[model samples]
Target: MEILQIDDTLSLKRTVDGGTEEQRKAVKAIISEVRAAGDQALRAFTEKFDAVKLDDFRVTEEEILEAYHAVSSAVVEIITEAAANIRTYHEKQLRPSWMTTAENGTMLGQKVTPLDSVGVYVPGGTAAYPSSVLMNVIPAITAGVERIVMVSPPGQDGKLPPGVLVAADIAGVKEIYKVGGAQAIAALAYGTETIKPVDKITGPGNIFVALAKREVFGDVAIDMIAGPSEIGILADDTARANEIAADLLSQAEHDPRACAVLVTTSRTLAENVLDEVYKQLPHLPRKDIATEAIENFGAIYVADDLEEAVGAINQLAPEHLEIVTENPVGLLGKIKHAGAIFLGRYSSEPVGDYFAGPNHVLPTNGTARFSSPLSVEDFQKKSSIILYSEQAMNENGAKIAEFARLEGLEAHARAVEARLK
Candidate 1:
């Protein structure tokens, strides 16, 4: 890990990958084929990419039961508890349809409606993240989406991971599919013979999956184009070096492009954390990935004071921000940007990743400056409602016509005039 002085030139912004031209072309072809051939295209692509030939793509209830048997009872209980916490958190975000009326006999408000259907893509390749299934699916369920579909790649044995299946079941997902990559995204965006199209797609995947989401965005809604994991820590001399090092590596192990940074007021703490990170790196199972990430993107900065440290971290706008200062809660109001804020030593970043009630799906690559984490609002749409009594229409009809005619919209003016007469 490199240590440096905080300056204006320092930035944590990473370039968002848009995929190579060849990859884009391939994604376009896959989407077109899925739209044209439907289920046949899905089967062919599953065979070619996943090396699993399946006449049916959907997971059966029997398979789900088998998945339960494969997983330990303790793990099942944990997932069930996590699902309950997530549901309880998201249910607070649900808002009711509201309207207001005045003496003029006019009613205006917004009606909130959950999406008809949603597709959640859980990545399958090097590892299976059951946490993602809970993070992405629970909010949609909370919003009362009628249909929720899950798609993940099957292993060489032609079965999805047991943990992933268990999490989906606990999260109230009834539909699961054994397909992945660009093709699964296509199937979600455009209906296949067996899988109906969804109104929105959410979750993270490889570069190809990101590209497919980008291509299909306008046709159907999508979550943001997420980048690799990131963690930014604001600490002081009171913070422990070893604990901070471990929290940084937790995100570093996720991807080679993952970033971990520390901005602190203590030079002694900075040097100790740098040494501690190197000492701990060799022992991790994902040492190769974490080492690459740490060598390339990890850094420790010594700021003049706590105010300077907070300012630097706000500029980074990290996906996860941990405040390990003596008074972490006092600094909360000063934090202008962060996907999730963990205060004090006990509230580590991983708490939010798994057991914590907050959604782990967050904006990365400095996008937290403008966007937000995945929430129930993402799975719901708002419709504006307008109502006018006859008296109100008579009072404002001429003014409405004049305003329309001012914009040279004669047809619009005539429509209101006809209603008035």
Candidate 2:
């Protein structure tokens, strides 16, 4: 990993944004064909990409029932604990429909209703992640989504990983499917003969899966255009180099494109953390992927001051940000754009990733500057609430009529005028 010395600002927005365009175009093309072709396209793509010849895509209720006993008690206990934490966190994020009545007789309120159905795409085959099942399903359940459907590519043996099935069931998913990749996204976007279309889709997958989600976003509501996981640490001389290095390796192991970065004011600290990262990498099972990710995108920045370190961190806008400084709470206010903020040495990134109540599915790349982590709010929609009495309408109708005429939307103004009259 190259150490970028921050004496001046360099625009990183162009670099990150420019990288996804090609993948986006290819994904958009796949979605269009799949939406138009429907069932046949899904079948063809399943064979083409997943190398599986599946005549049926829906997982049976029988399979879900059997999934319970397929896993050992130890795994079930872990999933149970994670689900409870996730459900607890998301329940707090729930906001019911609200109203404030005026002195006038007009009744008004916003109805907060969950989507009737939603799709959760769990990556299967070799890319299975049980944690993602918990992250995606718990919030949708909390938001009151009536039917939650899951899709994942099946193995040659025609079964999902027992852990993935166990996690989804624990998180309250009502259905599962044997489809994956862009076609699975397309199947969720446009219903096939077997798989029903969903109102929204949430989960993480490969670049193809990500691109497909982007293509079908408007047709079917999507959580975010997810990229590889990323983490940025803002530390000082007071921070522990070994712990900081471990945190960096954590994200790097997620994917080959994942990024782990450190920005610090102390030059010696930067060097020490880099050494620790090398030592830690050898102990991880996913060392090859983490090594590729860290060697390519991982970096350490030595800043002249804390302000400069923060300025660069903001430019990155990482999915996970940890302040491992002496007074992490003091530095809390300084961070403006991170999917989630972890403070103190013990409050590492993995706390939020697993047992902590917060959602692990978060905005990636620099999207944290504008987007947010997934929550119950993502599963629900809000409609604007407006109320006006006859008196209020009568007083304001003429002005609204005049303004509507300026925009050539007189019919809109006339509706109010007619109400007033």
lDDT per model vs. reference: 0.95, 0.85
Residue-level lDDT of model 1, residues 21-129, one tens digit each, is: 9999999999999999999999999999988899988999999999999999999999999999999999999999999997998999999999999999999987999
- Steric collisions counted per model: 0, 0
Candidate 1 Cα deviation (angstroms), residue 279: 0.6
The TM-score measured for candidate 2 stands at 0.92
- Runs in model 1 lying further than 4 Å from the true structure: none
Superposing every Cα of model 2 onto the true structure, what RMSD results? Answer: 2.4
Name the best candidate (by TM-score): 1
Using alpha carbons, what is the TM-score of model 1?
0.98
What's each prediction's TM-score?
A: 0.98, 0.92
Candidate 2 Cα misplacement greater than 4 A, ranges? 9-33, 106-108, 419-421
lDDT (Cα, 0-100) at 231 in candidate 2: 91
